[model samples]
Target: MTVTAEREPAQVATLDPAAIAREASPEALSGTSRTPALLIEHLSKRFVVGRKRKPVTAVHHVSIRIERGEIYGILGANGSGKSTLIRLVSTLLTLDEGRVAVFGHDIEREEMRVKRLINRVSVDAAFFKKLSPWENLVYAARLYGLEAGPAQREAVRILSRLGIKESRMSRPVEQMSRGMQQKVAIARALLTSPALLLLDEPTTGLDPRSKLDVQTFIEELRADHDATIVLTTHDLDEAERLCDRIALLNDGRVVAEGTAAELKTQVVRDHGGAATLENVFMTYTGRSLDEDVEEESDDAE
Candidate 1:
């Protein structure tokens, strides 16, 4: 693997007063007065690959806490372990080290409770190709113990909000465009008002318009449903727009974590010039967000 690092100075920018107040007041966001909706303490995961017997440490000892209704973003390049972190919290993969909890319920000790409180939507969401969006959603609802009548009603409502036409709801999911299918996947995750939602590259492979639609829907979900969201994305603009706080991951460790302005300020202070989140990623990870090691290797050969 090739590694590079850039240094930049941090600059401070003022945030709107309303934005500051909204973040400070939890009740203004999440409706419930409960403990933090999600918390991960020193979570870590590793994988072994290749004939040479190399261990790939996907997630290092990382810690994060999200208050109910906060939209936290994990920003990194591909293979920087964003998806692995999401999988660990969602219980799709066992943690090689550390612990995760949802609403104070230990993920390891109270697996069922943690599972019920969280839902994860990945880029490669699986669906019965032959099944219509309505059918897929209904099946998901049933699995979540939601009744058919209410579930169907919610499916239509949420899908419509996501810009999926009412007529398209009954068509085969496989027949829909990738963007439409992604919307349906999101709708499925929302079928039961999960207190915490994990979205892994929810807007990847989308057209610009579709990307905006998904971003808007995510904001709406948090605003209307009071859902705390944890999403991983390679899109820096998306991260800047949607995240209350962003954690930059490089080589399986959190190299930086803060609000956008704070991180930018760090770059300016440390590196001696104006800085942005893009600069922060470049400085710590030593590669453009648009570039990856595999691509570089291919180009070199």
Candidate 2:
């Protein structure tokens, strides 16, 4: 299981549905606010590797503002702090020097509120391998205090949209393809109808058709559910296809950011590379996108 830090500065947000309903107002729960969905100010994190050795700085003074209802992409190799940034925002890891706000609510001061507003789907999602997708999602809904009947109906609706047949939903999750499992992970995360969705390498190991299905669902979520998504991915094409804007991270810092067109234009104007997102990433990071990060082990934390 993924072990988040036990003690942060504030009370951890209770994921129980009753607690969430009691804490959030109608407008806040609706996710239709003028404030940005996410705000990170001068964020930083460091991990001590060994005795008498220098601490590894995983994230360094990164500041970002994501407007409501936008799909923002964070592109990086394995350990360029992409996951670290997401962890911090999701309150998995404590910050060393920064402030994160979700929809104007401080993550530290209003953790419960923040939790009510956002949900995260990691690339390595965990589930009961022997259990069926429906069972797993029903358990999740119960944890979040949802009614079983309504939750099952919603789960079936969502799974069907993601291309999971009713027959397949009854089979063990381990029997399904990785892409199918990933779709189940996404469906489970949406049980609460969170306003801000954090997707970390969402389509990493899917087949072509499955990738398209998941991508289409992401787009639909934004259009129909009023979700503001922060997505991290290794696929440049996926980023270009799904994101409204992109930020390229290198060695724990943002090297460049803009729309796909703007980034391609910047690379051509400044670095004389081909007008493409690949070239933009390569020019800014001084390495090919296919190359793994120099600090790969940091992701295990």
Candidate 3:
């Protein structure tokens, strides 16, 4: 794989405000890419944890083609390479083999251009803990070349839509609950109007109601904006509800790929089981959906 970026990962990592600030452009914000939203071919990424230990193959040779405006989900157990795949596409991790393209622009050949077209939200988002939600979002908007006055107004609209009160906008993010902070992260990613949004375990820690709020907003974004979302989550119901198609990953490789209903029908026909995503997971991965969720850690997911 070619080195597509000259900068360090921190500059273009998830929620990369500094990188967005440096590379923002009017065309980037226009969201007018005519090609498929995302294309990946034989992608692979491995991590060298120690000299004595062999490399960990985090993402195997995975290939996927996502059409414009589709909501795609990468569903897997913990450490199943869900987040690793998202990181690879978001330009946070380098590829060991294969290629990724966003809107016909090759990620390696046109790194900066790709950066402008995409933004990422991870399970644990970072922020200026001391800064208010409005402050943090406006700062991100400025990085994306959006005008501050309009940016602030848009931020309010977004947070309010997410069920955050206007009164909470001025308080330090450190004071907010985990679910509220996650909502703020979603708002920040949307502030730039990214054409391709990468969400890694977006609802991992939220309560049921908060999860519902985020899921509803996600559906609305796909319906109302020029947004193609790639979501990585283990929530079976969430994937069945939000994703247009789902890919189940196991041990860093795709075990099954199809719409939720398709997968369920497949399992029932081939494996003799209930027609549900939960059954689909069990059929393919040889384990229950909730098995060992806490034992194996997903690296920096």
Candidate 4:
């Protein structure tokens, strides 16, 4: 399990669900009065490694903003700083420099308020092995200060929509497949109706069918709940299918940012006709997005 510092300065309590929904009203969302759901400025993170001590810059002066109700995708290879960025925004890691804000509240100054506005679901979602999915989600709900009755109902509803069977809700999470556990983690995050949802490789390690299920669930969440999402993934096809806009991150920096079609158009213009997203990624990052690390390892041996 990942661990970080436990204490931070307190801020105002989280806004009520009713208040958040009211702010997300169609009129509010359509008007200029709407505040951005997330704003990140000049973010950077570094890690120290080795006995001789070397500094590794995981993220370097990266900045982006996600509007309310938008699904923004970050596309990158392993160790390219996507997860590090998410952790910084979620306040799981203190920033080495720069700033992040959620719903106009500064993450550093208003940590609790920022925490309330967002929830993160990474590939390796932590859960109690002995607890059932329903029980785990209920526990999460309690932590978020939700009442038992409404929390239980919402958990069931979200999980069911994610293709989890009602019959399996009582089984221990350890017995469930990885995909199912992922769905449960997502459901737990949605139970609090967060304004900003950070999903770090949410579909990683899932079979095709399960990936589709999770993708569909994500679309529905944005449509029905007006949630803003920031997702990081190495799956270019999934990014093309699900993202409203994508940022291509390579070596801790954003090399390109545009809609999928826009990116493809740029590639075609630069590299002659018949250029695809794959070609675009190759041209910009000098690496194929489909090249698996395991395949490289096998070849090396």
Could you estimate the TM-score for every candidate? 0.85, 0.86, 0.86, 0.87
Worst 10 residues of 1 by lDDT: 7-16
The candidate that achieves the highest TM-score relative to the unseen native structure: 4
- In the range 1-301, model 1's lDDT, one tens digit per residue, is 1121221211111112232232222432333444455778888898999997898899999877776557888888778888898988888899888988776678888887677667888987679989998888889988877898898898888888889888887878889988888888998998866767899999977889989999999887666655678988878889989987788888788888877777888887887555777788888788986686466356558
TM-score, cand. 3: 0.86
Off by over 4 Å in 4: 1-30, 292-301
TM-score of 4: 0.87
Q: Could you give candidate 4's per-residue lDDT for residues 108-138 as a string of tens digits?
A: 9889877777888998868998999888888
- Ordering by lDDT: 3, 2, 4, 1
Q: Per-prediction RMSD in angstroms?
A: 7.8, 7.5, 7.6, 7.4
lDDT (C-alpha, whole model) for all candidates: 0.76, 0.80, 0.80, 0.78
Q: After superposition, how far is residue 90 of candidate 4 from its true place, in Å?
A: 0.9
**Global CA lDDT computed for model 4:** 0.78
The C-alpha stretches of model 1 lying farther than 4 A from their native spots are 1-34, 293-301
